[model samples]
Target: MKEGNAISDAHQVTAWPPIRNLVSDMLAISQRTHNGYGLLEFDVTTPLARIAEHKTRMPDGISFTAFLAYCLGHAIGEHPGVHACRQGGRLVVFDDVDISTLLEKTKPDGARVPVIYIVRAANRKSLAEINEEIRRAVRDDLYDDPAVRRRRRIVRMPALLRRGVWWWIRRDPVRRKRQWGTAVLSNVGSAIDARPSWGLVQSFLPCSVTVGGIFERVCWRNERAEPRKMMSVTVAVDHDIVDGVPGGRFVARFAELVEAAAGLDEEFGTSAGDRAEGQSR
Candidate 1:
């Protein structure tokens, strides 16, 4: 046979990072996790407008993701059962709403990787506080984070030992919270393309949220059709721990909060309607 051109085809095979195994381990745990997902769409025109205006005043720009995180925290606080993890015969529920999210960080070699960042006591934090925290994490060298360092060591172990470590961690709710978090919020849409879509994300946490894109859509208001900004979001909870009644309630309350721009009005003193009125004149 003549020499084939297959060898000339450009292809690069990169070594898989050990840390990816950590995510794989988490996905493996999800096999045993029974999750009920609520795919929701929220009218975020007010919040987006408010966030845009707030950015002009504050040096640290407001993040829509942070606002959603704030809303998720309070919502979980009201329905604590959604954040409860099952430990053998009993259920372990936590009051503090700890949200674990992945923020991209650049390594010294200039390779970008997602680093796990936990927003502790998210319920008690204000919008500005959450915004600044997220911004700071983006600026910081997250590879130096102690939690990331510890996780690096864990990923280096043999596959069996690594799996065993995760099992041991999951056995105790407190341990899981300390190591992973009580809940997870993955905002994949915000960081990626502008395509408006809902992401169905899987996680090992008791409660998880996947925030998608904001796109303009026609909505009926006062029997008149008007263009409004809509956001795609998904809220998931462990079905074994959280029932439908409470889960539905949590989604309702969360939608109401986001649609009404709950945290923004308290800080900004006006709604999108009010801002539009001033600009019109």
Candidate 2:
């Protein structure tokens, strides 16, 4: 066929059969059940630019997703009570800061698929450790877990059974904490198909943080408009577990950590106790 010429050979068009996955199940739960929300956006202009330079000099470059998750975990660890979940008319606050994050795994055929993995006690891990864990998630076949396999089958059941299972899982505070962690985190900065610098995201969880794309813009600095790199971030919290003051404090601390992200080596050796001490000082 020549350029701009339409050639018809009577090819059949078909749709891919619907298949149930964990993301869809979670997305359904997020959309239908989640009610309370508190949002905060950060002006991460200079910090992101510095991180870009650091990435260039490294052999195994650090991704913004990994950095973002570490900072979130640290902040949550410091204020664990604020990320609590309420169930059975009781508030369950977690002391250990675990995080659920998404990774784009590449298949043998070079196709990419997103998989959810939990970073247990992420607040205790260093920046290097967190980065390695995220990379391992991309390399490993995480969906091979027996429980995940079982859930795949369970999702195919009737709607009534599905709802019942969802309720059973969600209603129990311990089970909910084990499966979904204290918070869910994601970064759409590299999502080429999404809108430039996508800001907020809605999901059903105790806490959620999402990092959007980086853009360059002119903003007032010393009463003059100057160009700078900027990134948008969104944090959402469920009201049942935490009040507005705590949530606001958590967001403020998270923004402070993100702004200091460019100096990552100091962040690497600090344990949870060290972080607490630094914050106190």
Candidate 3:
């Protein structure tokens, strides 16, 4: 079959579901179960301060990205419901953790496009591997490489032309299988700045849970009035999957894990002992 014809058939098989219906159903079930919607924020000043103090010599050099992904996976493993998706008015929870990292590819003319892929059985990947995959996906060279461009061109037509194709392709019964996962991670850390005023949730995706990592800021203690580095994390979740209490609990547990990992002397190969020796100067 021709490529266009194949895409058309796939879209027909994989019809996108309505967001409001799914959200409402989830909310109703959660309410019946006494679950509530929730949002939680954390202040990482102290942990960051501790990391910076030992950075000179102990540079295990783990990037913040790696740490964030590990924390996300750990949290999902602890809170299973946080990784659920709505399927035919029912909640389908995934057993594995597959965090989708969003990437923006810059074309020759400067237009940036987003592409997503599931990192199969992601919980099995180590911190270094996760970090490397993310780096490779975002690299301009990877996006612009001749071979890469050729492959994309052959497989993906312009969105305008592909719409009808996608519609038909999605209609296939088998193609409609749920793309559920434990959670979704959006690393906006590169755009580090003040907390964003707003963000839009993608309407047709299987992401019931989403987390955004914003710019790191300097946090200060109240009484001591000391300055410390910190990063802000924003989580937007489907009200249907989890209620406020459980949501808050999940965030708290996730934060604790991040804090502990951040404080590790051997994280990213940097040792506290090595840093202490250098600080002696």
On lDDT, the stronger of 1 and 3 is 1
RMSD of each: 5.6, 6.3, 12.6
Clash counts per candidate, in order, are 0, 0, 33
**Candidate 3 C-alpha lDDT tens digits along 144-190:** 54433533553445445444443343344223222323456666656
Number of the top TM-score candidate: 1
Point out where model 3 deviates above 4 Å.
Answer: 1-39, 46-62, 108-111, 140-182, 195-223, 262-267, 270-281
Q: Rate the local accuracy (lDDT) of all candidates.
A: 0.82, 0.70, 0.52
Model 3, 271: alpha-carbon shift in Å?
A: 12
Q: Give the TM-score of candidate 3.
A: 0.58
What tens-digit string does per-residue lDDT give for candidate 1 at 126-154?
A: 76667667887888877678777889999
Segments in model 2 whose C-alpha atoms lie over 4 Å from true places: 1-24, 31-40, 192-196, 222-225, 266-281
